[model samples]
Target: MLVDLHSHTIFSDGRSTHAEMVEAAIAKGIGIYGIADHLCFHDNPWTTRLDQFEEMRSTFANLKANTTSAKILFGMEVDYVRGCENRVLRLKEENHWDYIIGSVHYIGDWNIDSNAADWEGKDVDATYTKYLELLEEMVDTKLYNIVAHLDLPKKYGHFTDIDFTDRYRAIGEKILANNMAFEMNTAGRIKICNEFYPRRDIVELYHQLGVDVTLGSDAHHRNNVGQFFDEAVALLKEVGYSRICYFEEGQKRYLPL
Candidate 1:
């Protein structure tokens, strides 16, 4: 079964509507498609407004009631801001989501993935260090079902000479301890990084550490639904992963690769 669990719609930064993305997923032969639009309090254009939350839920409900070709999951990609634990917890309590993808898009109000211009004059090593620190904290919250776009700070080709292998392994171990799944986000391949999120070596490391994974295209447009997934599956199998995971009402389940 082909499952692409992370994607967006007009409710966030995506160009496609929910229905349009579903159609594209069906055409791409996805057996389980999840709509995980952004949920953030950052007041950015990409963040879904608080007022639209109910609409998103209702629309997804309508879709779930009508669509049958593929199993549709209601999800959200929440930004992991340092001082916003209460907000995240409250949102989690209010929504009945199949999965919640925790992403570190910001480091103390500095948007990491917003654009390359924001990266100017930044200390590469410090930035990487901070990103990892936030990731560790996000895992400790024990509030997320999946980690979205691991190593997202590399989105703009910024490099740090410092080796963070040990730190990454610690985080991987924490993720496993928390029973959170790692996400192999394919959107990075289309970005300037020209690679998948977490990188192949990280994927291999996670596999060796016994961290289960799930696939996500991070598609913003309908055409990109399930994009590069074939490559993702091949890479996972090459790394000794014979199966991938999905979620149902927040419970993790596996499928053969």
Candidate 2:
């Protein structure tokens, strides 16, 4: 049974509605599906608001109540912006979400998108350093169940000139210390990079550090649901990960890949 823990819907930047995403998951034979829409952040114009969150939550609950074939877990893909702990805490307190995935989509003042050429001639190492710093801060919040996609800057080719192994190892140690699972987001294969987020080497390092892993498609559309999931499982297996993590009632459990 395969479980995809990261996905989005029309409530945020995704192209499809929540029901459509769930139906697509069913078609893929997924045993579990998590609806993680983008969390509201100060810089991003596309962030979800409180009312939208409640609406999405109610919609998901209603959908889950009517279904029995596939388990649907409600979640949010929170942006790891500076000083985002207060918002996270409030959301967790008010909602009964099954999981929360903290992700870093921006570094300092720069946003990561499909445009890699825009970052030309910039200091790659400094940018990564700032990003890692934010990652460490986010992990310290202890508000997220999983870290969405480590080394996401690679998506924009920012990490090409930087050796992020040692730095990532340090970050991995912190993530392990916090007992938070790192996600292997398969959406990258279809993104500008045409590769998995964090790449394989970073995943291997996380495994070496004894950190647990979760798999996500980071799907923004129905067709993108569970994209490249089989390959993600194969990668995890190659890295010695026997199972993938799932969250329920603010706790995590492992499921076989």
Candidate 3:
């Protein structure tokens, strides 16, 4: 069964509405699909607007009520910002989300993943170090169920010079310690990264660590709901993953490969 729980809508940086995405997922034969729009600090360029956030909530309710062919879950992809744990916790309570995908999109106001060309003066090593630090903290807080796009900074060919294997190992350990799922994000297949998030070697490490795995297209468009999933599954199988996970109402379920 194809179960995907990481995607966005027009409410955030995505291109399709919830209805269009549902149609796409159904066509792809997905067993369970979720709409996980960005619910980050209001300052980010891709964050959902206040009014759109409310509208999407209603859309989620309607979709959940109406969807019968496939399970529809309401999820949030939140950006972890230091010193904003209270806000994040409050938002979690307010949303009553089915699952939350925690990600680090910013490091001290330097939006590393926002653009690659703009990274002229940024210290590549220092930047990723800070990201991993925040990731460790996020895991410790137990504020999210899945870690979105692990090692996303490698996207856009920006980390070619940096070797963050140790950092990634630490991040993997934290995810395992905190009982969070490691997301296998297929969006990287289309991004300049030219591979999945966490890379194959890192994924193998996670498999060795016995971390629970989850897959996400990170699709922003309707047509992208389950894109690149076959390749992702093949990679997972090669890495020795026998089961994959999906979440519903914050509960994790494992599906055999």
In terms of lDDT, the best-performing candidate is 1
C-alpha lDDT of all candidate models, in order: 0.92, 0.83, 0.86
**Who is ahead in lDDT, 2 or 3?**
3
Candidate 3 regions with alpha-carbon error over 4 angstroms: 160-163
In candidate 2, what are the lDDT values of residues 1-257, reduced to their tens digit?
88898998877788999889999999999888898888857545567777776677689879889868799998888888877788788887888889899887776666755367867877777877777878878888888889877877767545557676887887788878877888989988876667897789899999999998988999999999999988989989998999888897778888977
Candidate 2 deviant stretches above 4 angstroms: 114-117
How well is each residue in 1-257 modelled by candidate 3, as lDDT tens digits? 88898988888899998999999999998988988888777487589866675677788899999988899999889888877789878877877888989988888777777788868887777777778888888887888999988788778877756777787788788888877898999998888878888789889989988999998999989989998999999999988999998888788888997
Instruction: Look at candidate 2 and tell me the lDDT of residue 20.
Output: 92
Best of the two (1, 2) by TM-score? 1
Clashing pairs in 1: none
Task: State each model's C-alpha RMSD to the native.
Answer: 0.9, 1.6, 1.5
Model 3: lDDT equals 0.86
Cα lDDT tens digits for candidate 1, 35-83: 9999987889999988998998899899999999999999999988877
The clash tally of candidate 3 reads 0
| TM-score computed on alpha carbons, candidate 3 | 0.95
